[model samples]
Target: MASRTAIKRLTVEYKRLQTQPPPYIVAKPLESNLFEWHYILTGPPDSPYEGGEYHGRIVFPNTYPYAPPAIRMITPSGRFATDTRLCLSMSDFHPDSWNPMWSVPTILTGLLSFMLEDTQTTGSIVTTAAQKRQYS
Candidate 1:
């Protein structure tokens, strides 16, 4: 069952996202499930991901704000494996560092910032710049 706090927070965040959407990213909750969100991310310019529009989902826990959500990139970005959960600090992989104050916009921006980095992790992939550019 979803906590009232979780539902309320998600609702407020959804409205904020709709009214004043963030740059390079747009997201919304699934009509049937508030815990499941779909998002579109425009690849940052000057990076291998430039000119690409990546789609993915964020699965929030009922105990969200206390527990981070799972993040998966569905697109074939050479930086991370498709359909695999990313090992990011803001993701469920590192809950200890998560801040309850961080909102959906913060998470998406952080995700995009991390995507531009060349960090290696469990779900991260290693490919040549050319390959990444071509795949983007």
Candidate 2:
């Protein structure tokens, strides 16, 4: 169960996201559970992931803002492993690096930027540009 603070923060974030959505990203919490949010990210132009619409989930801890959330990609983008928790500074894997000021837009924007790069990290996979294009 999410704490009252978590729920309130998430609610405000959701409203802000809807009112001023970020480019290439759309996210919404599950009707049944605010802790579980589903997101869609459209690959940026000129990238191997371009033309792709990747689906993913973010599971927020009960103590959000203070704790990071787990992020996983549901769609195959030839970048990150499907359904696996990605190791990012903003993710639960690196809670020590998480910032309470970081919001949903910030996280998703960072994810898109990372996806455009070839830097190796846990839960990340490497593939040729051609192979990545096929997935796109």
Candidate 3:
């Protein structure tokens, strides 16, 4: 079960996102579960993912913001395996580095940045720019 503090924090964050949304990304909690958020990222300009609209979800731990979230890209971006948990600093892969101060926007932005990188991580895929464009 999620703590009251986690629920409250997530509620505030959700409100802030709805009113003062970030660029290239839109996210919202699932109607039935505050711990699960769905997001759509407009691929950053001038990158291999440009013009792509990638969809994904984040599942926050009961302790949230303190424990980091599990993120998975559902889109076939050619840079990441669809439906696989990404290994990132702000993700479950690096709990020790997670900052409780980080917000939902931070995670989305970080994911976008990571998507543009060519470095290969456990859940990441290596593909040509052409292949990425094709997937886009």
Candidate 4:
């Protein structure tokens, strides 16, 4: 069960997302489970992933706002491994670095920025530009 604080926080975030969505990203929590949210990211223009649509999920811990959520990309973008948890400072992998002030938009924006970079990290994959373009 999700804690009251988690539910309230997620609810407000969802409303904010719907009213003023972030560019290149769309996310929605499941009706049955507020802790789980599915998102689609449109690759930024000019990037190798341009024209591609990546699917992913964010699973928040019940202690959300105080703890980071687990993030995973579900689509093959020649970047991150599909279905594997991504290691980011805003993710559960680095709880010490997470800031409760960060919201859904912040996390998704960070993910998109990181995707455009070539830095290797846990759950990240390496592929040629041609492969990435093809995936896009």
Q: Would you list the C-alpha lDDT of every candidate in the order shown?
A: 0.90, 0.94, 0.90, 0.94
**lDDT of model 4 at position 32:** 91
Model 1 over residues 1-136: C-alpha lDDT tens digits? 8999999999999999999998899999999999999998888788888888889899999998788999999988788898999888888999999898888889999888878888888788999888888877
- Evaluate candidate 1 by giving its C-alpha RMSD to the native, one decimal: 1.0
Order the numbered candidates by lDDT, best leading: 4, 2, 3, 1
| Model with the higher TM-score, candidate 1 or 4 | 4
Candidate 2 worst ten-residue window by lDDT: 1-10
Q: Relative to the unseen true structure, what is the Cα RMSD of model 3?
A: 1.0
Each candidate structure's TM-score, on Cα atoms with residue i matched to residue i, is: 0.95, 0.97, 0.95, 0.97
In model 2, state the lDDT of residue 18: 98
Off by over 4 Å in 1: none
**Across residues 59-85, which tens digit of lDDT does each residue of candidate 2 receive?**
999999899999999999999999999
**Given candidate 3, what's the lDDT at residue 44?**
76
Where in model 2 is the C-alpha error above 4 Å? Answer: none
> What is the model-wide C-alpha lDDT for candidate 4?
0.94
Put down candidate 3 lDDT per residue, 7-83, tens digits, no spaces.
99999999999998888999999999999999998877888778899899999999986789999999888988999
Instruction: For each candidate in turn, give its C-alpha RMSD to the true structure in angstroms.
Output: 1.0, 0.8, 1.0, 0.8
Q: Please provide, for model 4 over 11-110, each residue's C-alpha lDDT reduced to its tens digit, 9 standing for 90 to 100.
A: 9999999999998999999999999999999988888989999999999999999999999999999999999999999999999999999999889999
RMSD of 4: 0.8
